[model samples]
Target: MTEAPPDRRRAGISILSKLLAMLLGVSLLSALVAGIVGYRNGTDSLRAAAIERMIEVRESRAREIEAYMDSLRHTIILDSRGIAAQAIPELHDAFRELDEEPVPASEQAAVRDYYEQTFVPELEGRQGGEADVGALLPTSDAAWHLQASYTAADPDWDVRLATNDAGDGSAWSAANAKYHDFFRETVEQKGYEDILLLDDEGNVVYSAYKGVDLGTNVLTGPHSGGALQDVFEQAERATSVDTMAISDLERYTPSEGRPTLFAASPVGSGGQASGVLVYQVPMDEIDGIMTSGGAWEKTGLGRTGETYLVGPDHLMRSVSRGLLEDPEEYRDQVVANGTPRETADRQVAVTGSVLLQPVESFAVDESLRGRSGTGVSTDYRGHETLGAWMPLDIPGLQWVLVAELDTSEAFEPVRDFTRNLLISVAVLVLLVSLASLLLAQVFVRPVRHLVSGVREVAAGNLDARVAATSRDEFGELAGAFNEMARSLRTKADLLDEQQGEYERLLHTLMPEAVARRYQDGEETIAESHSDVTVVYAEIVGLDDLTRDMSSDEELETVNLLVRGFDEAAERLGVEKVRTLRSGYLASCGLVVPRVDSARRSVEFVREMQRVVAAFDAQHDAALRLRAGLDTGTVTSGLVGRQNVVYDLWGDAVNLAFSLPRANDRPGVFVSAAVHDRLRDQYSFREAGTVESGTGGSSTGPEPVWELEEDSRG
Candidate 1:
């Protein structure tokens, strides 16, 4: 090389600068190419993974919803074939007799006032329109009487409307007393909003919850042309028990205009379809399935992800998770997205989105067209989202399930990866030709250790931890990752403990067999026993004694007596059905049949007498127990939706309750059937006779017998 001036050398570009330029160019070029290629592949993979996850979740939810509909169909068919067939004849007869009985003008006026003041206003408030109070008024004498006594006369009619008795001593009241518990329990246990029994004439013969629809004739009544009437007519035309009619979810004025779905099946006996059994499907269940009980995260639906049902009308069938998680945000989003402010406000007010929030989206349109796929589309909230959609397989329901996640959340990891890769590329380009080996040794080893630990944690080894050998960013990341794994482990343990507690509480609330049936997804628990004994014990003075005591004192006294009764009944092999105020109902052979049911029931009653006697002597209170024992065929099962109770119904239970009140004195009495069963082993004398044709099978005076003072097994 010739000696040259520094200015001339610089101007000509030095060899060292040339080599540096080439190295920088190559390094920057390679880094840029790698970053672009890696970003494209990672984003494509992430998008595909997100779509696939959405599809999987959508399919799973759809299948579950379809199975739930199938279960409802199966349940309706089975329940219709059960008490509906046997109960219709007696209920119809009683209904007819009540029609013949004259309705007092005062009672009819009370019913009319109830509609005007209570029912029509509530219906209008829920359905969002005016209602004709006169149109909904009972048109039949029986309707007037039943509604007057059961629906209007009840002071807490809105609260405890499921109560079956009015003590009005009418033929319909008698019939209601006989069969109402069975139907009421059915509604509760099966999670039915209500259960209605309709005769072949479309007359709503009985209502489980004693709503305004209790005695209305669906064919000619105010609700004649509605979904109830349609489903009733379809079910009436059914030739077999398997044939059923399912109504779409609609606003039902009778249920306060809540979105209601009805499933109806023919009720038949002896090859004759005599009536229709209708079940109001509960909204909570469908919503629970869609929202996974509001645990969207557990279903892999991260923040801003949710699944919901869209009906044929483009209205939501299930409640929106947005409404539940963030009501104010939901309101603002919905109002901004073409939903009227008033409508959105109403949905928030109702704490529901069903049949109100309109979803005019491409996903819903495609789903309605019966085509299922995954894509990016604008959601109901007007946010661009990754969605998977499918039409539900449930019959008579043109509903589609759409699972969606906001694109912002779905692409978050890709965004992070791109950003992190860009930074890494810039660093690599700058340092590639300078101290490259040193950088690899210092940074690459710690990154590899961190990556290995991340892989271990990703593979479910939560205990896998890397040592933070140096106080660098990589070491801090390792420490953070380890903490995250520990937190996840703690949360998993908490979830397990919560699940165990839930299982324990379930078992405590229900009998072992019933609890297992519930676990196995059996909703209704009614069963019939051909031969059984029921004991009804009334603590005559407890109410009077408790009247003077404070609420806590009264509760303590009641608990003490009930606890003692429960202990004695358990020891004597008697299953206590439930307690009503001061009355305790128990039976043998109700849950587990026993051959010596009558004897066990009698012994149980004697123990109850002793329990009351001990309390009277100890507290110097006149707590007398008058118990009645009866042996006959009866139906028994678990009832109620939230606070479940075991109940017994039939001629046997009715007669057992009637025996104690047959006489003025408080003593242990047995039904004629019970006395006949136990007379040989225990002493008995004729107590008195109670008219038996009220609602039971007996047509004449039935003799009541008293258990002698010295009676023993």
Candidate 2:
């Protein structure tokens, strides 16, 4: 037992451990798989959201870019042929001479002197507010698109030629000062880089952000190869002054070679073409729109997301996100795109800051060809990136908007989600494992207790009882086990009592030896005995007394008298064989022969007479009792099925009953066979022999005798 407990506990623990392990293993595996799948799904969802955000940013920038261009075009037309389009005669003559290509050096020197002495002073002398300058303002009917060449073909290109050198009070000076503020304030409020008015011959008549551009003919100047030729040619062919034309994106040396677009519209007065209004709209304004919406923040693109426009030539038209926030990364990105590192640094310095240098990527290439879609690909910086691209809907501008970001930055939220998911799954699995182990221990306790109790019962210890620890199946099992043990004990007691009763009944029914023979499975019960005494005793008036008595009283009186006889017979060493209707039949030495069998029968008969006489006296009634005895060869046997009787048979039993006569009194009457056997042991009165009559089964008459106890004894 010392070793058994440890071994059994180990076995129990091992079983519980295995069960817990299986359950937890399956649960954790399922949870892990589900978590991984959920993580992947969540990641994909974030990616989709990022791409959708990129598309929105791209669309928003496109709209703002279009709006910015429209504002510049509108401002250009309002000012042209109006405030800054005055073609003074002296100004026209001066511009005409200066517009000559490859003129004499002296002629160019004279034109420069004229601009320093006349144009510079008159242009700076404008003063005060001019609220009623409407008369000076040209009507919309003024024709600006009728001129043919890069010459002073219309007066609107003429700048007011300075003459008197009187300073700040002249009409030209007043108008110069008044509209100077107009151009400057337009640039401030409307975000145009420059607003220029050109003559019909494409001469720069007036300039905002005034530089060398004023008083020069753009067709023959350093910027001649730019959109000036196209604008003049288109204006020459226009049928109305409202005719507008736009040039493709390009760099103009007049604007320091930054990317620019020229939108030119003709100014008109009374349907006569007078001048062309050109809005020197810089691409930088579009760049500002591209960066307006905080796309990275709204779209969850975080650090590296950008929205930019690209021309049909596949060059970026807008700035990059990294250029603004992370110039170092932007430098590396542009250097990788064929820019010399020193050149990138020089260019960034020359621009007074870094810029998203132009570089074509997969998205740019696709958008340039009018294709539109979204995907993951290497970006302009050669990093794996996600992007969405679509063409802009503005007319005459084959431009596209693209939104892009590095994949790592775009899917940043997904990464964080996955990390948290991993931590949560690990913790949950741990908790489940621990919980399973504890539950296993709790569950196994009841089973172990039950096993121990069953083992005790197997070892025959019925007292070994299991404690019902909980209201569960184990408790029910313990209760059932206790009931089984009790039932076994009760059955054992019942078996012992039943066995005792069986033996007693068997003994009461027959002699011990005969009963033993029956218990041994003997089918027939019979025995032959020589000189066995058979006696029949009767209550003399039992039938007559029963007629006068109630049923229960008659039965009780008979029972009392019969029981007294049986007691006396038992005391005299005789067996009471059968009793019927107050008649008692007894045998002496029927099972085993005895020399005193007849004498014992005579004593039993004397006892029966005394018992009957005493019963009559005790009850205060005269009840006759008689006995007849015969001593002869008799056969004894058991009869009946449900209840059996042991009695003497053959001649001896018949002669005993025949010995009684109708005239006989209440005394023992015996056949001569009994007198012959018991006359010496006790005295008897000899009676005359009687012939066999209807009352007897005997073949011949037998002498009878009256029985008495021996007085000498």
Candidate 3:
């Protein structure tokens, strides 16, 4: 006769199997969650870091450009001061000494002779010796003769005429007659290119050269419409000592391109405006400071990044990089009809503060207000750029000193870092995941074998044994399993009796269907029908009850309550699932059939009330049991591996939980879904809807009906 299968076999479970299952499940879940969270956090951190870095770059550029503008202002101021010192003394003396004196015909003839022979020879010889011979000569010799004739006509001609004959008889002229000669000679001899003496009303009194006419209003000169003339007028109106001014004259020269910096200082006599000592420096010269000392090439500053000058009227007066070769072209491309290239100009104007890499271009018209410095980044001339703008304090010109660095160049390092960081992160994730998977397989292989062996043993195969491969924990576990299997084989004859005891234990611990599911290694999903109902019972104030008790005592009381509820549910042919402390989740007509889910729910409630009353009668401490019931189709399944539990899900389960909280009367509260299913068989009080927490929607008021114990059939 074939030997009967072993009944118990110690349930054939090794500690290693439990430990491995727990570890794998927990590790996989933890790693997956951690990876997702880490990726999100890493991306957020990178984006924030990028923005902060860009802001810093913008701030640095703003400070740099501001310093550059200050340097340019100082250069212009120093030049003005130098020119004023040289011209002011002579101009004041000439104006102050003007007088009318009488002269005889003989003295006049002598003065005239002295001027032509001594003074004229000296002036001609001086002009010839000068490096710029053409600078001293007018286009027409007639202009020179007219000046000489004017000198000869003066009345006090002989008194101030300097003679080479040492007071001997020579032609002479008044001091006023020599003034024009002195003015022309001084201006040319001093290397004052393009000199013009202006009267108080801003009219050109005389010109060293004839191409530009004298007796013309300086304000209406060809090169006088722009900022240059404005600076001159401002200085003429000033009452201060030797006032100075600087401005940018746009379109000054049509061919040489771009604007020029017009720096001038007042030449005054005893508080009366005499003339302006003006100097014109091409705008490129001031902007050259950025490229000076070979910083641009040496510092890896790209050609796309350049420094430029912008007028207050939103016009690019001068630019470097030769990208936009002409000032007009640059202005046309960026500022069309006096509008800014980007919207950031509005912000810069409003804030009057620096915006670092604002991702937009700014307008000089708006951003040049009130001595503020700022930076912005935007598409300039169709190319991405990082630009900084600071107000240029040229005395009479409203302009901004602007510097731009191409974004691709400025953030190259950041781009490389981001690329490398992403590459590194990808590599790390790949390596980690690969290593983890390999390690898991290596670790789980032995455990799987041991589990399979134990399961075979539990299935009545006493011959099942584990292979002892290595000397680690797994090897030891395998050896222990083998030993236990051998011992089980020796007791094979007494297995029939042990099988009865094992069945009794299983039935005591769990319902028949659940025990069968565990035995068969089959997952069970408990389905609910119209005739099925779910009940959720919870013990109130359980947390407070356990606070004062020892851990073991707390556990014992919790287990007792859970066990009692489980027993009651099982007796009524309901599947009970244990939850957190003081709560038992169970469903009727899930495993067993019922006529009406509401009636079944009522019966379940009545039974629970009877059990609670009996227990209260026996014990001094009355245990308050609150039960909630709801009838609907619910999905129930076994969840977890080691500590497996049969759980119910869906809106039905949520409503069931809400019902108990809605109940004020001590017994059971049934949801509308439940009440409608069995309203004829069971009577209930209309409690209406009570706000309760469920369904992931905040605590909501749900319709609940109260069922008293007496109302149950």
**Model 1, C-alpha of 326: deviation from truth (Å):** 2.5
Write down the lDDT of every candidate, Cα atoms only. 0.84, 0.66, 0.54
In candidate 1, how many Å is residue 678 off? 50
Q: At residue 474, what lDDT does model 2 achieve? A: 67
Looking at model 2, residue 704 earns an lDDT score of 75
The digit string of per-residue lDDT tens for model 3 on 489-509 reads: 877757768888977976654
How far residue 218's Cα lies from its native spot in candidate 3, in Å, is 1.4
Report the alpha-carbon TM-score of model 3 versus the true structure: 0.38
Q: What is residue 139's positional error in candidate 3, in angstroms?
A: 12
Residues 1-713, candidate 1: write the lDDT tens digits: 79755663335764555566666677778988988899999988988888889999999899899999998898888888887887777778878888898999899889888888887787787767698777778888878878887778753544444666788876667777788778777766877888888888887788877778877899887677888887987887776778779998888877878889999999987778988889989999999999999899989899989999998899999999999988899999988888999899899888999989999999999999999989999998989999999898887779999999999998888888888998998788768867444543454343777778778888988788878787878778878888988997888789889979988976655566777787787768887887889899898878789998998999999999999999998898888777878899888987788999999888888888898889999999998889888888888677887776666788888888888877888888998888888899999888888866545366877899998889878
Sort by lDDT, top down from the best:
1, 2, 3
Task: Tell me the deviation in Å of residue 351 in model 1.
Answer: 1.4
lDDT of 1: 0.84
Clashing pairs counted in every model = 0, 21, 14
